[model samples]
Target: MTDLAPLPLSVLDIMPVDVESTPSGVLRATLEQARYVEELGFTRYWIAEHHNSPNIASSSPTVTAAAVGGATTRLRVGTGGVMLPNHAPFVVAEQFGTLSALYPGRVDLGVGRTPPHDPGVARALRVDALALDFEQQFAELLGFLRADFPAGHPLQKVAANPPLTGKPSLWVLGSSENGARMAAHRGLPFAHAHHFSPQNSVAALRTYHREFRPSEYLSSPYSIIAAGVTVADTDEEARFRNVPAALALLKSLTGPPEPFPTPEQAAAHPWTAEEAAWRDQFLAPQVAGGPDRVRAQLADLLERTGAEELMVVSMVTDPAARRRSITGLRELFGSAPLPQGLAL
Candidate 1:
């Protein structure tokens, strides 16, 4: 086995809406998860932005970040990414700037270029899909955050309000070579969506490191690889618990998304050949097993990608099981070893 140094661990919460659970309940659960992870010594807790997805309750990560930031003392609260095409650059700066003023040194602004909605929904949101230029929008967002517009620029005098002593840390979230190059060009931190785009993770990380240039935000290249994980007392139990989330992911890809199904419901549902194949392929990169298995998988991932940080996302339907999974991961990676009875 390859000996790997312990890496910083973080959480990425999608605020999954389980069957029969209200949106408010899901949001509250997210807050509780943040607090729980903080106690377990996780470094950061990030929420994602997903519009029109019934299974995902987090549509506004900025609002969730504020709530989580206020609820916890030491945990860094941020957006896994706010899809930049959905909102105005100035609005994002002001919102995150206010968060910085309130939370001081604990806010991160992660931005991505993808639109969170379909064409019709995006039209409803009043975003011009064809005219959207991610590079321009990204540059504008940084300009607003830094208050560094050039002379005679129309918004040069318009300042993003609630300016604070220090700005929120900026990160460019990506899962592709183009996105990696963009982050490198801007000299910002990069986070790869390894959970969703495992195929591109290593290539993207390599591009980021190879093309990186020093800037005010960062003097050197820094990268995080975010992955899906679930750990239980035994490998069998962990695999059983992962079924519902795996089913949910398949549903999202195949058709109109549905709320997260219970494990029983997932097991009962009929699976077509194509769906089964897809599910297996998707599960290939995810970490799901006993403590020793999860620890080994994560260590391998860190070695392969050389990620400065590891962000784990576990979207199990059962709250208790979810908490236990996180706790198990903490124990596996932390200085402490697994309890005697639970040893692999």
Candidate 2:
């Protein structure tokens, strides 16, 4: 058995916009939370991009990455990730290259092929959205980042500016076997989206490890598992806190997405048998309990996945509750501390 020693932890924030909160308010909260987690000794903080989603405010992760990077001294900031087909590879290279230039060694660029929006919204963003070949786009993006355009390549004359001081660490995000193979083939780090697609997590990770090759960025395979979590003083309280996010995810699948509901709203919700079952199934992979229970379950998860790192996403609606959960996690995992009162 692998030793149950503490592993590296990070945060993946979707910046869920509550009904009463404005986009600006969500952004502010995210920045503050990033700083707080940095104090808790989190290695990195990542934001996701989602378009046309009422509940999620992070439409531009590059912009948010810059904000979070500027606010904290040591936390590595990145996207969890940017949907590459939405924009030109050159633009992404320039944007992340600029971030690397500003922050030096504290920048990361995680890329994915999944479109965050539906077909119509995707067309609004790019006229030829449906025709995009993600594999080709991904290769082009890497070429720009590495400054390795072939001698006669059309983009050889163009350079991503301001030039990167050092290449930002790259990660390929996926929830499928194909994504795992691609990341492994390229020798980039891989992050599996276990939080949302729990069923495929093990298969994807196994595929990545089997196909991995050593490269410039890493001498061995590195993988991170992104998992959803909710913790409180007791299992009962943790389950209660998770209600809102669970209801929000269910609504997103069945109808138009809404802002995260409050605990009271979730409590008052009229759940049918089917809906209740759906909620339980959706939350099967999540870890929610008091410190001891959470720690044991997380250790089991690490043993099963063999991940080098874990990136957690906690979606409790109350700010104080969220902070307390994060603080509890830090203590549970034995991460090092910052100055007193910083995390609180």
Q: Each model's TM-score, in the order given? A: 0.93, 0.94
After superposition, the stretches of candidate 1 with alpha carbons farther than 4 Å from their true spots are: 1-4, 253-255, 336-344
Note the Cα lDDT for every prediction shown: 0.83, 0.84
Q: Weakest 10 consecutive residues, lDDT, candidate 2?
A: 335-344
lDDT of 1 at 316: 81
Model 1 quality (TM-score): 0.93
**How does model 2 score by TM-score?**
0.94
Q: lDDT by residue for model 1 over 20-79, one digit each (tens)?
A: 797898888888988998887778888898888888888889999999999999888889
Model 1 C-alpha RMSD vs. true structure (Å) is: 4.7
Off by over 4 Å in 2: 1-4, 127-129, 335-344
lDDT of 2: 0.84
> All candidates: CA RMSD in angstroms?
4.7, 3.7
**lDDT string, candidate 2, 1-344, tens digits:** 23237767799998887777878888999989999989878888999989888888889999999999999998888999989988899999999988888888888898998874577777788737658899999989888888889999999988888766544488899998888898898888999998888889888998999899987777678888998877689988888888888899888887888998888888799999999998888767888888877888888888887888888897776778889898888877664443221110
Q: Please state the error at residue 60 of candidate 2 in Å.
A: 0.9
